[model samples]
Target: MNTENRGAAQPPEPARGAGPGPAGAAPLVDPLAAVRAERDPAVDVYLTGTVFLDIIFTGLDSAPVRGTESWARGMGSSPGGVANMATALARLGLRTSLAAAFGDDHYGEYCWDALAQGEGIDLTPSRTVPGWHSPVTVSMAYEGERTMVSHGHEPPPGTAPPTPRCPPRTRAAVAALTPGEPAAWIAQAARLGTRIFADTGWDDTGRWDLAALPDLRYCEAFLPNAEEAMRYTGTDCPRAAAHALAERVPMAVVTLGADGAYAVDGGTGEAAEVPAIEVAALDPTGAGDVFVAGFVTGTLAGWPLADRLAFAGLTAALSVQEFGGSLSAPGWTEIAAWWRHVQRYDDQNPAALRRYAFLDGLLPGAGARSWPLRRAVPTIGFGRGT
Candidate 1:
């Protein structure tokens, strides 16, 4: 798709509750009318915020001691956060675009190349900082766990570049923020008639004001990992944290590393518990980003909530099997096939399978649900059961 003409077509109108609308008639305009008035394009996904260059170093036995040097078996660079999600979505056959800032440095160029050439993601409105340092993360993987050390400051504000050539069927916008200008960016996307999905970065914890929650309340989904949820909602339990967040947002999902995830609609009491995909995790760097990509893609494709969770879980499981973030991300074809096979075999024990399916769907595909079946298909080579 052409990146130049995408978001440059027209200016967005004021959203319904921005201020007073049409006189005494309630002041607020009808949301449906506004949606219809906007040209609902075929843009599959708009990803904004948290674009970074991730340098992954794999196969470490322990943290680097003061003077000791560890053998670095593997190293590679890939897109991080929202950028990673955009690329994953594009690889899964979605029309995706990225809106973020990058420095004019070599690191920024590397990030741009990964998103553009490597994943075919469009970068229309992405800004380039003339003399700024682009964000970078150094991730170290040991056993199955990983730790990240980040560098660089947030990108400076500037007029967004023209939109690129994108698909016309615009569906959802995923915003990954590290506590910088999230409210304004989110509002802008919302004005364009796109649903918003939010993910908080580790650095955003104490940096941004929580009061911004009210402004972000209109978001369709709010995704935060277990620790971030606890920090944001002031709770220890993932479910409680999700509930706290849901009180302000429409929907909330808290990802619990190996435990899985829990989602709830603050508007309703409905909730779903998803389990983690069981895999011999090689690296956990971009697992959450992959999960967000899969979930958003499934949701935009009209998959049921259960199916969405399943897809997200499966994608994350596949991601851990490889070293770099995007390298291990599975395509839609792989995810669909795995889901179908798991469903077929799960039919054996009706009652037990139903509950297992519900829990497994939470983990990605049936990585955890297919544990016992692993012995049946040893060639697939998923690790021992969870």
Candidate 2:
């Protein structure tokens, strides 16, 4: 593929004085500009799922004890769940649209504004139900892992999940496949020619049956972690599981947490693997979602299979170094900065750096944002008077 004009162009570098400041100041450089130039103006990616108000507690040396009260050194608040992926795609300039239920409470209002206005995601298909309370998740990050406690009420009787009867016509959509329940919109969107990329949560029922995931037939790609892939395919190796899964889907991507990711193109009988970048992770929340967003961006831009895997791993690597899930996702500026920063170290491997050289033509100039962009603050509300 000719990558020169694939539309991954980024914004011009900032001026000398324009160092990284606030998060919202920079305009997002669309990675899909080139592709969209020749295509219709339909939404780039559409998704539907539950949204949660996430309160993250970080800077912990170990997991909280069973009885003692633990005080975390740092904390942040953001919209999570499907909102993480939605924000990630929108920040990458994918023209993302989301359809999900929201409570009419303060948390719902904040999440709605954050995604719709802050991240430039389309929420026209999303609705807020009266008297319904938004779901909430409290995450505590320690030792590169996290423990979460979530709470929410089932919507009042007769209230359905916010899936539209007729989903929008988009280039692609992300689906979370449940074992027993099938999402009708997945098949609906596929019939309309929308490429589907799906990922599944842990099956609590312990029946990792591939037949249970009926929506796989419509998915263009299925992304599952190493454990999930192995369980579902009944294979010991994740790579073998990817091959087994490719028999049902056009492509299969299996993420190996620390080892990086592997992908197989069933259509071409080709495969690619990329090693994960080492970073001091503060929170792992939403890292998987960010990885999927990156892969979708690269795939939609017609990049090579290897380049797509590298980009996906790179984005997820960057996301873990931050505080919150949705807001922690890096933009073009951050990707550009990381590329430039790594080149300055003498110990860096040339071959490793070369893997990400595709970013050379797509990143911002010398004025790219500084490494470690500003993160979300702990509080969600502000004082009436400054």
What TM-score quantifies how close candidate 1 is to the native fold?
0.71
Over the stretch 214-323, how does candidate 2's per-residue lDDT look in tens digits? 99999999999999999999999999999999888999999999999999998998999999999989899999999999999899888999999999999999989887
TM-score, cand. 2 = 0.91
Off by over 4 Å in 1: 1-39, 103-107, 127-134, 153-169, 177-182, 203-209, 336-386
lDDT of 2 at 238: 98
Lowest summed-lDDT stretch of 10 residues in model 1? 372-381
lDDT tens per residue, model 1, 1-386: 11222222121222111111121211222112323435555456776666777788887888778888778776766667567676666655566767777667777766665556445566765766676777888889987778889887854444334333332236677765555444565666666667888787775456445564544664789889888888877787889999888887888888888888888877786788777767777678778888998788666666556667766877788777666665456553344445555567644556434543532432242122222221110011234693
Collision count of model 1? 23
Q: Give the distance in Å from residue 30's predicted Cα in candidate 2 to where it truly belongs.
A: 2.1
